[model samples]
Each structure stands twice: as C-alpha cells, then as structure tokens.
Target: MTMILGFPLAPIRGVIKLGELLQEQVERELRDPAAVRRRLEEIEQARAAGRISAEEEAEAVNRVLRGMQT
Candidate 1:
C-alpha cells in the first residue's frame, strides 16, 4: 500500500506510485527556490569537476532518480 498524492492510502506500486511521489516532491521542491538552486549548482559543479559528462550527467541524474522510483 502507498499513500498517494498525499491522499489517505492506496494499494499501488511501480510507475504509478513513483510518478505521483516524484511529481509531488518536485512541486514541493520547486516551491523552495533555494533548494532547487543548490541542486542545480551541485550538478553543475559535478560537471565541472569531471564527475560526469553531459550525457553521463543526464544518465546519472536518472539513475539516482530511478533509485527513488521503486
């Protein structure tokens, strides 16, 4: 079971559950300008430091994102 859209509860998993939570978190984080700014800065810093290339950065972001997916 999962609590979705901040709703009481629902028995769901995988894409639906993940998508809802991601969207919710994204919206909430979007409201926090500083946090979003910091995240972008961190990503840019990583790119500059050669931790990730543009392509790798995209993949790495999604990989970290996918960790939260399920």
Candidate 2:
C-alpha cells in the first residue's frame, strides 16, 4: 500500500470505500475557513517542533486544500 501521510492507497475495497466516505465528510464538515486555518496552524506547529519535515508538511497542507475544493 502506498501511504499519503498515513492515508493508505490500497487495493482493498473497504479502504477505498472508507476513503470516499472520509472525503465526503470532510467536504461537508471541515470545508471552511476556520477548519483550513486550524489545519494550517497544526501543520506549522508540527514543522516548528521537528515532528514533520517541511516537504511533508507542504504535501499534507496541499492535500487538505485540494480536498476542500468543491
């Protein structure tokens, strides 16, 4: 399985289904300015704390943004 920041890209049907559901949930629930801001803040903190590399943080932030698109 390929992992996109712990998000697994898998051949399993269940995983794919769950991914779809998660995407929908995020779109409906977390697709807002406040949600985006919080995600950004968390990413920045992780980067400053040396928990995740700059590149990893960028990828994660990009993914969250792309997911928010309608």
Per-prediction TM-score to the true structure, in the order listed: 0.40, 0.59
Where in model 2 is the C-alpha error above 4 Å?
A: 1-25
lDDT of 1 at 44: 77
Clashing pairs in 2: none
How much RMSD separates candidate 1 from the native structure?
10.0
> Across residues 1-70, which tens digit of lDDT does each residue of candidate 1 receive?
2445645434454668899999988767655657655766787789999987999778765644554444
Number of clashes recorded per candidate: 0, 0
TM-score of 2: 0.59
* lDDT (Cα, tens digit) per residue for candidate 2, span 1-70: 3466445434576777999999888677668888888888999999999999989999999988886785
lDDT of 2: 0.83
Note the residue pairs that clash in candidate 1: none
